[model samples]
Target: MLSTAFALFCFLLAADCLETHVHGDLFVPDAILRISAQNISIGGIQRYTTLVNGSVPGPELRVSEGKVVWIRVYNDMTDRNTTMHWHGLAQAASPFSDGTPLASQWPIPPQHFFDYELQIPNDTAGTYFYHSHVGFQSVSASGSLIVEDRSNPPYKYDDERTITLQELFNLTDVDVEQRITADPLLWFGENNGFLVNGKTISDYGVIDNSTATLAVIEVDPGKTYRLRFIAATALSYTSFAFESHDGLEVIEADGHYTKPLSTDLMQMGSGQRFSVLLKTKSCDELEQSGRLDYYLQVETRERSAVATNYALLRYRDTCNLPESSVHHLPTDSYPSKKPIDLPPTISGFLDYQLQPLVPNNFPTTSQVTRRIVLNVQQFEDGYYVWRDSNVSWSDASIDSRRYTTPATPYLVSLYTNQTAYLPKYDAAIANGGVDPTTQTFPAKLGEVLEIVLQNIGSISKTNVTPGLLETHPWHAHGGHYYDLGGGPGAWSSEAMEARLQGTLPVLRDTTMLFRYNEATQPDVKSGWRAWRLRVQNPGVWMIHCHWLQHMIQGMQTVWVFGDAGDILKVPRREVEGFLTFGGDVYGNGTHVPERVHFSEGG
Candidate 1:
């Protein structure tokens, strides 16, 4: 159901609009994404949902490395505002295009289009993705963004394939959102099924002959293929395992090449990506075994009923067909490889072992200019809500009408020299601390920051057993950082630096903070994760949990890099119409603002 009529024409336009630059050439209007509400079916379950180009998971976009491209996104939905977030791409110079609503820029209202200028750094060449950053639309509105290597890559492969993993929600996004945010919190942790490239067999405790198509990745025998995976799930920690294949060499993680490491099992949380080289079996061996297809089993690792999904990895010569197509359910006998029983701790296996291919000159503890310690906790003020330390990120204290999604974006107020509308915060709070009034963290331009996120058992307003702990996948908006790893009880900087032994850490834009409780680790009561980065990108960036339910409950805050003047340094043409109410700053009158700016800034 995806529309592809404008592919060839878009490429031609990109070629003709190139302008030479220092890093590479810049292409204007490289591609156009049209978002609309469509009636689509996934795994035989139909739902009226929002989609990009009328597809559940949007199309894969492949571009050469070290290139800048302008992508135009149009929202055609009748009643929803949206924004696009490039998951791993570092918007170094164009910070406003980071695509976080209210923090980076205003959300693109319905029936309007916005142009996003994406600059892929020369060093960033691997797997990544783009998704909606507002509300729960990311569940259905997302796609893979691949930056292919212009020259010869480090690893050789005969072919390549992309697999996007997700969780299926049978209800409408609005209904689901209301349930999660309802006073009674009727939305318990229950999902319909798991997805592999938007296809799966419906095994929700029923025996129905639904011939749903499974994603088929055909490969020639005795050839190696690079399998790129993006975890676009809203609330699932997925684990993948090959039925009869082993020795998958992981070469890339989060758009950065890693030292080659072989593993039989691969695990990923939301907003994460990786690349693995899979070598197919020989033709003679496959013929002898009387099997030309294998199953790639995917399982959800959350604390619930483990939903299983399957995808077919077929050989090229299967059934003597020209090309092997999708494998439907109930046709062939299922593979013997079922989902493995793995502990939650095993999910962090690759985080510590996979080192960066390019060594980094790590900074010593003495060089760190600031350190931030944040505690993750859950409370029940009226309904259940998650928070960082003591406060959650809602603007109800300032403006009750616009609680989470502000009527006036903080960036717009800063640009127009209107500070009264924005949240009040003390930037001189020594070491750049969090301001509960504004729910923002302020940092200088060139300071090196070390952030520690500590997770503790849930605290509530009632007397009951503490809620079970869950793995929280934290993601950053502006750029990537060095992952220094996680711990059991509490975070200790001295201990972490000593353990490094003057070695560099793996670079990533998103990582997981493990949870601890009486059941998991009796000796330890809390868990923690540490990361380090240089505060170079000048703009308002958001740091939040990738899980949609938690994010909606206010488990997020914004980081203001540099001052208002620094962010205003961005070219006026890039953010002209976006900072105002009409969305006509780009000299075109297409966009419409959904809400009025009640503050004086507008």
Candidate 2:
């Protein structure tokens, strides 16, 4: 009887193990995200907004590093198309999953679905995010992507939190786009309020005694917490800080580990993320002194209109009561203020030195194979046009309307031997022409390329502030680049050589292009930013200004690496899948429509 019982137990154990492997481990991080439009209450007013999985900020997606993730996105919205870009993920082997509309694949139209299979590299374990890549849809359809490191971490922290920073607008996304096209100078409409993690403190002026709940962070005494802050705003650059809390350690920026630097205030531009470690005070002492509540403040930067938003941080064990029962601190405790005063040495966000914790194995500056100089300038041929290297990037619909012929997708052109869409550098430079509308620079695989971005200030209109240059945050897809030092003025070959003689550069995916100033002691001139990276990933990659307005206005370009022969190595099946479904799928899955163009008129 004992032998028979033992044999039966073994059989059952085998069945359980088989089921676990087949169902649990194989599909560990699978998710089905439903995209639709819904009326949600912000502060007190109800407004129609785009949403993913029925939430403003969507859902927090956590996946372990070195694992595969499958996300099936279902578009249920009746009016608009949707595509989700895994921002900051290299998408090295799976370029189709990059999710750039037209460039990677067609937009998922209403009542359609798309499955994205992504493999997270073992080395890329950091804070990232996902958002809509089509039009202004990302204003609401966005979420945080946290990649957990399997190995031990370099820093110590007892707990962690993720906070998404955004700005709330009264006008819908469609209305905002229409306004942008009508007013050339208007990039974004006025934002009504700011939000922290899709929640904010009720503003008495905007709404009358609203009962909106503020985002709360509960922490134990004597414990350290790591906070991952993501700037998901469509238009604002935000400065964040915790009142009465000091010794914040910034350890990571833009999904790359950086040298630990301590700072009082942290600044983040759109599409940027930073991780900071905060040490909490003891609960016993705080409760005794009646100082258990603290405020997390976020303020807008680099804009004429400014607003501040606040959240709550309370000690979990201070009162031994539920979080909802805890009384909120007085609204007047944290007053809205201008930029906080910091020492001259650490005043701007660019002042902090971000050195990569892990050394990259790439060629040095002296070993660079290709060098390109691109200048950003605003010109007026018939209308205001922003151009980089003589060409203002545009899509098929825009080119067809302007030139009477639809342009092909840059990525498709690169891999399929369609060279018309590629930029003719020699002709463009010689004639100072920006014809053809679509532009791309070509590079060979494994070549170390250096791109110097020279910024020339545009002439401001009489009604606008004169002599004020707009600050641009530039971002690149596919891989992170090494940020060589940059300075004021057009970056000449001599200037680059002198700058590289100084300290070794760091790795960064998103960087700021500061405005030029001539009267300063240093006599800053037109801004210049430079970066170098090897073309290890053989695919078409996009490099563009992160400002949503700038990107839509042709302030973007692509770097096509390798020839058609090299692209053939990428699985034919995968390439065929994109070719079959790419371009505008709004009607009949064709490239264009007679009356409605997907890429024209904002």
Candidate 3:
């Protein structure tokens, strides 16, 4: 009897993975939606084509447990090349069709097509999305890719809806480049306007003439609904909430199931997704009135921005809640501003320094490796830049590694370079400072590695964002490690360079964002800074910003897994040299490295 019951339970769990008929000829469908600014008195005044497929928010695709999913992408864009990446869904198995250009696969050229197959091993369910992994994230090219639930869920919901709030900077491909290259801070793409479905916040203000105000989704009030939200903006931090006649309840986040957290305020950032279960107990409004109201509010002010979307709860007149008003909030319905329990601050999101969100789940503290900081400087023009000669956009450009010259390393001339150098905002780190002639990435793996991101020059709060001091989420492709804090230095440079004379723990495909410094307390909401990960995965994995821009600018690098824990055969090599990392880092993916073959005498 016991064996029969166990077998029955397993059958039920496996039954949750129902297959969906996929329309091949597409890998990540570039969305084609309409975008118009809100509050435009005249209708259709400012309009443009958005990258979402057939719908403003594209379709969601789910892969089965232990199955391979094949994707064929068709790019209809006549202008820029486009590619799609299954964001947050790392490849531990084949890692094919990962969709990152050059580093992973070549991008699908304009008006062309490409096909890829992903071999998903273990079963993992979550609310994930696929976007143009090639270049600018906000300019165009992004859509959600949901991996359906193969296992029965605990929550009860009759329907499910995913809301992706995106921002649009109405500039042409070329125009955006100039603005970003000139003043990355002012570039609207960084953290500008938004689109729900494919419209803007002030949809009500300009519902008739504006294209941005059309994401009103209709729903029935008597039925339970699930709202899956993804914060896909480059750098727009939000504390979002939903309001109908009553309040809202949230159930899941980052695709992982979580205990319900009922609050009027919740925060989400780029690369993060959440699921909210909206119950219909008080859904009587649909019957009494005529229309059930759902409101999404967003504010773009001095230091913050927020946006949210909801389904218009519909009912067959017998429901119990207010019916006349669809989803209505008082004219001034936004809650009185209150302190939120969000991550302590932006630093909490930057895990390159003191990774806060990363799980410190590694073996024993066998190794303590330290990385040296090369550059962390912010400019008056609102852009920030990091410099180091020891890294490559894709580990070593070649599939193979070469040994010689100790990678010809060098520390930047901070004092001299600070005053003389102008800030760079493009991705083109093609430099000869380190002799690519001999050096390679993941030098002798299996050794305890400590990568330090030193901040030199000066940081000005007046020009940069508040989270500048905070370390960013540093994700190691093939390993996991603990988080060490971020500061001026550990104990003097010489003493600190003692190297990891110990063994390091093992980590696999984990990520961590750094915490902000509490010294200059500004906002104590998002907590994070720097972190370390144990490299265990033995493959070529690339790490970059979930946001498209920062990543386009050489923000990505390769993590190579050498022989596991073989320090003797793969001993570290110490050498003498001065090399600079520069160029193509800020270019479009395919274009970045090419720039190295052309300019600065690379």
Candidate 4:
């Protein structure tokens, strides 16, 4: 009897050990990140802001396409709540991990933890990024998320580099938010300087200083390098180019591979990414001719307030030279000068025709099932508040009527079949105090929805000389859309049809809604941008302006697909786990109030 009992115990222990080993091999995270607030210096001034790990712009996370990635984010922030959004990622059935605060999930409060298990779908692999989505925290807590295609890429490149372009301000995120609340006309905070991979060139001299270390990309003479450019700014629209380098072939935009279109300059809005191929000349030949270095220049376009920033692209052996031996181009020769002075038009060279690398059977415009017009305008009570389709997007606010006892998120309401705050399209026009029913736009599953984002200037103040015309970079979650061509001002069906011209549109996740110019022509109307989205993802998706300030002041909305039946298709355990595990524990049921608040009238 004793010998039989011992055998049974050994069998049970072996089974348990085997199970543990198998689970560990399958479920271990590819990368673990810690989100915290840290003081970092920029442009010679030190300021405190949220950061991932210990770096501003965080760390680059790379995962193979179609692989399951387990990411554990530990929030070490003491005061602020935080959530990291996987920008441009189609979370598909995993809506709970979408990371929009009060939409998909709650903020991972101080000393809390959240584990995100993301499966990068084989079909949807491209350049994306992760950043804080809670309030103004994303101003610093951002990083690149690259999904590399496991199969051989169609484009030819010998090497690759990631370039992150961001705008920095002297004020803290809280202070910036306060200023914007006081005066909505501030838009995004005043841009102190621009940065390339978290560093800037010295302001005073041609010498490279320790304080201002330019991000360097080393290259061999005879090899082609793939440059992945991410415009991760909170506000600014940038024009990017490499000085004295003309053959920049843009092969990918927003993760979709496109036909190679060579251009001297590329324009990127906030949350957009582009991959360009740069072929280097023979280093021996260039050295023989005395040209050894070049600058990758990025500058704010369509606005005069931001400064230009540059990174060095040094030849492999050129670092032996003195640090002061830097090459500076003439101010007039910069790419920013051309785009700023030229009329706003899509260049076949820059905005080339993009088609999917593996062409799937997608419906054309004629097959679209629904059409929605999103009119972008400013609503003024005392301060400027942006509205879409006359509905200012509502969230759980202290002063708003939508605030609930448990602080229900907009997405949680949809998942739980709670319709108390679901906004109706028509009622949102006049209803004021945080009515969710007015702000929500509903759709059906697998429906092809066409959204025409029309920007007709603001009512409060003119941001630029050409009226209330301001650029808005619109981003959609949970899906990629086909970017149909846009035009100036209100688009009629006929105009849209003409713009399509019976061709397939480029697939992208973020698109810039350009501002209209009266000076271009007297008959020009306010600017408009159009995109066709297939509502394949069932979860409530947040669509908003990537301009962080605009999104804060109600320039956002949600697209609800199907009904409770469709929402229930998601794993019940995932929904419950998110509601129970995610959220601010310190505030209990109530939300922590912002440092600044607008007056009731404002």
Structure candidate 4, residue pairs in collision:
422-437, 423-436, 423-437, 423-438, 424-437, 489-526
Candidate lDDT scores, in order, read 0.72, 0.66, 0.42, 0.67
Q: How many angstroms is residue 356 displaced in model 4 relative to the true structure, after the best TM-score fit? A: 3.8
Off by over 4 Å in 2: 1-29, 183-188, 201-213, 284-289, 318-352, 379-385, 394-408, 413-438, 459-468, 492-502, 516-525, 570-574, 582-602
- Every model's TM-score: 0.86, 0.81, 0.60, 0.82
Q: Least lDDT summed over 10 consecutive residues: which range in candidate 4?
A: 593-602
Candidate 1 wrong stretches, greater than 4 Å:
1-28, 204-211, 318-347, 394-405, 418-432, 516-525, 570-575, 586-602
Looking at candidate 2, what is the lDDT of residue 10? 45
Model 1 Cα lDDT, one tens digit per residue, 412-449: 76776546533343543643477555657877778888
Error of 2 at 298 (Å): 1.0
Name the better of 3 and 4 by TM-score: 4
Q: How many pairs of residues in model 1 come into backbone collision?
A: 1
Stretches of model 3 off by over 4 angstroms after superposition: 1-55, 137-139, 154-156, 183-192, 201-210, 217-224, 244-255, 258-263, 281-291, 299-384, 387-534, 563-602
* Winning model by TM-score: 1
What's the alpha carbon RMSD for model 3?
A: 14.2
Q: What TM-score does model 3 achieve against the real structure?
A: 0.60
Deviation of model 4 at 411, angstroms: 2.5
Q: Higher TM-score: candidate 2 or 3?
A: 2
